[model samples]
Target: MRIWSQCVKELAQFLRDRLTVALAFILPLLTLFIFGFAIRLEAKNIPVAVQDFDNSPLSRSYIERLYATNQLQSSRWDGIGSPQAALDQGIAKAAVIIPPEFSRRIKAGETSPVQVLVDGTDVNNARVIRSSIEATTRFFVRNSQLQTNPSLIQVRSRIWFNPGRQESLYIVPGTCAVILWIYPSLLSSIAMVREKEQGTIIQVYASSLSAEELILGKGLAYLIVGLGIAAVVISISVIIFGLRFAGDPTPFLISTPIFVASATMFGLMVGTRVPNVTTAVQAVATTGFLTALLLSGFIYPLSNIPFPLSLISNIIPTRYFIPIIRDGFVRGTGWLGVWFYLLMLMLLCLLLFNIARRNLSRMQLPD
Candidate 1:
């Protein structure tokens, strides 16, 4: 009865604060749209300067081939003496120079060297540019009667799952998980700390309400709020991004509330330990948001992280949940693939709730 009463009171108080209510609903959707549209893993339309000193038909064909993939575009190096100047001035990411003998050598069935300069400022972009140049050169040599002897081995490539290469299929589900993790924890942390900041927690210490009831009650309210947030953001993602379930949604449906409850419990623990609401917010932002963003494999694979950081990712619940959500949209492996992760997620949630219960127990009146 006390748990129900406390839950109602928290819900009522939450609804009364218009700003908090708006933050709960509005901010998450905005984050979803911003992250969905803005982030891209592949680099495209990189500008390159082409100095074709040969100016022959073969060189012209090669230049056209370079731009055929839509990955590279011609960049102007006006008032510059050399192709290198374009890179120095940041006008282009790469420069290609064809020698005078480029056409003659190739025509005589001899290898011709073309000087290519790439900006090393961003190593990944530089790698992409190098690969593009190499691939295009290989295509030109193989298909344009430029190779005197054809290689004995012919390669045929096939792309598996997500052949259309819709990036949203890769991005939106992970974004949904991150949004769900961060916002509920932030809101619940604020609710827990607000009572302390305003000195209203004295009543709890004086009342008969057990620490379990208080934590469960407040967490229950915020769990409902988190569910509502999830529904809105997920529906918007489906409508905007055309996402549909790839596997059994049963696991995703079962795990969401457990994940949200853990977030609320994490917030409650922070509020219990911190002196004020500001510190609680900062704690959640640093511990909750950063871990989810970097360690959870939301943007990159966990194996890519260094030894110690990779170890840290193991404990991040988001690490476990991202695979589940991604499986829901892209992999469709079903429970056979994701059951272990689901179990790990549930264990982590229980751990978080226990920690919060223990912390709040120290501050409450004895039963």
Candidate 2:
């Protein structure tokens, strides 16, 4: 792939300048470390898939009791098929299996082991699921004393399309979106600005290449870099975070390039406006990175933002991009849930490209 060449180029550039070495490697790692320690969102509305072998009144009652806690929600099992299948498909966070003798043992003054297989990819959420199960089991045990009824109805609810509440499910996709967007754009910005500082941009101004061609060519190169970044980041996420695809990978597969192109154009826009590499890098680091990270709902909800800044979030590409990514990995609704967001990403990409094209065109001087 072109990424190999790009990597070699990047290594050469970093070797040529120590400042480039710090910018290329150190900054990105710091960003990831900051994200790791700072983010601690509370878990709620977690989906628990049920495979009740007992299918008895007591088992159904336990399911109902678990759902009542509000911390745990129902998955798509509907009392049929393997709970493991749902977990494998990313349709549930935790699976509960009640053994055949569950009710009989409880009624006979014996304890029963209700199997709970939790998705451990998200360690914190796994802990929450375990705690919620224990508490609900205790509550159900206490409540059973007063109920003489021999029958109980199942409690079934929670986003019907499917579910998985692993923090990595939500975290990886959004984090990838931000990383893919910011890094490619930052690289593009720095490259173009570095060329300007070296006076090589004058060669482009005198060449047959139009402004669109020049900008598009630069973006195309970095787009390859962005996709490479995606592969490495996603692979790392899968190995480290244990995240898996929740649905058809088609939507995510198609949209990544479009999202990266928009990001590259955005960086080119900065390079076009600023005369120096330092200003271009700062513009990307402070304005571009902060806006994409904060406004995109990567780590926080858009609704939770203040009024003035909330309005600004609507224009942020990550605002639309994050939902599509979250849907593919966390919600498993496929294209149905993400089609609108995908369309929005396309629109934003076009908008950003037009702005970059115009800005670069304005910078060209008469011969």
Candidate 3:
């Protein structure tokens, strides 16, 4: 009961500290809100230009269908001007060029080539626009067929992991990984800095406690808080935001210890070197934010980045966790595919902990 009271008192004091409160609660929620709204992959409001040389009902109907697609916002240019002009000037994403012989070819039971000039600058959006155009064109061709015998060719599409392309499914899992990277690092770093700030670290080193044992205790404390943060985020994601949870708990269970251990070791290293809590916070923030943005395969696809940058990214531990959390949650992948990541995480923790322990054993505070 006495220990519990003391713990509660310390927690209260920690909470009352304005800076601690801001870092713990305000900044994290602010980041979550900003990133959730801004960093989406879904394309909207695709612009298209139409040049109808045939001026027939069939051609007009086809153009109408293109406008009807909610994904596309289309405009008509009634001139023989260059389709390349529309693409080059950024006036359109795609241009539909209906040749003069369109109606004549339809009447003769022949296929007329309707050229679609697409701006391939933004590849993903261009692909979606092209698909929508092709689908709409095929529909028009099928319905306008006046032949005695109708022929049809069916195309099938298969999407793995997320068939519906639900952005939340991909995003929520990736967000979970991002949260893991920052929260664990911040928590562990603060735990060490707090000990140093209170002048308890020297006594801890002077005592019989081994570096490994000290690290373990610190790891357990921060692990409890990290799990609490995960639970809160998960609850918000599932109950408030309606994100799905379709996978086994094995990945989450397995990754938590590795993440916490790595975080604790990193914190110890930072704490031992930086003189005060403020400097430690600065160090962690610089390391945490840049590492996540550049190295975690979140913003840019790892394969697309330059070879040298990719090599550097491979060394960031967060890179491993992002894929693991994403695969487990979105793809429902079992341990078979991601065991290598788990192993890598374990190795990182061991290496960092060894260095941190050595630093802690030799370090003395400056007067």
Candidate 4:
């Protein structure tokens, strides 16, 4: 009954607080809308330099095919000495060099290799450019040869996860991860700081309410709110953006509360250390936003990050949870595949809760 009353009190306070209301509801929606449009995984409108030395009809047709895909655009590089020079001058993201023998090799039924140079400054864009060019070239070759040779071998490819490679499908789950961490942590910490500002924390300390009870009460209130926010954002992703969940919801269902608890406790710990609401919000933002964005394998894979940084990512709770959400929703991995991450989330939740409890126990009343 006491815990329930505390939770109700926290809920009422959350409702009354404008900052908490904004953080809980408005901010998540705004972030979802912004990131939904901004973070695109698919590469589009990439400029490419074409050096068609062959001056053949086949070469011209191949260049047209590249443009038809809308992934690559031909860059104007009339004065460029070589495809490599065009790349050096940043005239294009990639360059295609078609040798003079390209058509002759095709006519003689011999394998002809085309030289492709890509600017590796952005590795992801470079990979996309290389893949798009290769796919276009293969399509051109297969179709062009089919007219003279009916028995030419043909290859078919299919993408299993995220077919058609929709960027929203890839980004929304990660955005959910980022939002979950930032908002719950920010709101929970601010709630604690608000208690200090209103001089209610001393009353809380003087009461018979245990630290665990206080923490659990505050955390439970935010947990329910966070889950509701997550559902709304996910529905927006599914209904509006057309994201589909491919796997069982059990893994995601099990991990979400654990993730939320960890985030809320992290905020509580921050609130205990910081003197005011502004400091707490800034702390939560810096810690939650940066870690979720950079270290959680959201934008970049942990495997690709350099040695010690990769080692450091292993400790971030979001690092484990992101895969759980991605696999359960996107890749459709069963429990056997995701059990490790689930266990890690549970352990992280325990650790964070323990630290927050200790911090709460040691909290000093404002002077």
Best candidate, lDDT = 1
- Pairs clashing within candidate 4: none
- Alpha carbon lDDT of residue 307, candidate 4? 76
Model 4 weakest lDDT span, ten residues long: 146-155
Once fitted onto the true fold, the runs of candidate 1 whose alpha carbons sit more than 4 angstroms away are none
User: Model 2, range 17-108, lDDT digits (tens) per residue?
Assistant: 77654554455545554554355576778998988889888788888999986688888666556889888888899998889998898788
Could you give candidate 4's per-residue lDDT for residues 1-367 as a string of tens digits? 8878888999998888786687688889999989988887778889888888898988888888889977898787784487788788888889888899988887887877888899999988888988888888767866776345545665677999877778877788888888888888888898888888989999998888888888889988888788878888888878877777687889988898898888888888788778898899789878778988999989887878897778778778898888888887789976878899989888888888788888888874433
Which of candidates 2 and 4 reaches a greater lDDT?
A: 4
Ranking by lDDT: 1, 4, 2, 3
Name the lDDT value of residue 100 in candidate 3: 96
lDDT of each: 0.90, 0.78, 0.73, 0.83
For model 4, the stretches where C-alpha displacement exceeds 4 angstroms are 76-89, 99-115, 146-157, 364-367
Query: Clashes in model 1: which pairs?
Result: none
Best candidate per TM-score, number? 1
Clashing pairs in 2: none
- TM-score of each model, paired residue for residue: 0.96, 0.64, 0.79, 0.87
RMSD, every candidate, angstroms: 1.5, 12.3, 4.4, 3.3
Better of 1 and 3 by TM-score: 1
Which scores higher on lDDT, 1 or 2?
1
Q: Model 4 compared with the native: what TM-score?
A: 0.87
For candidate 2, give the lDDT: 0.78
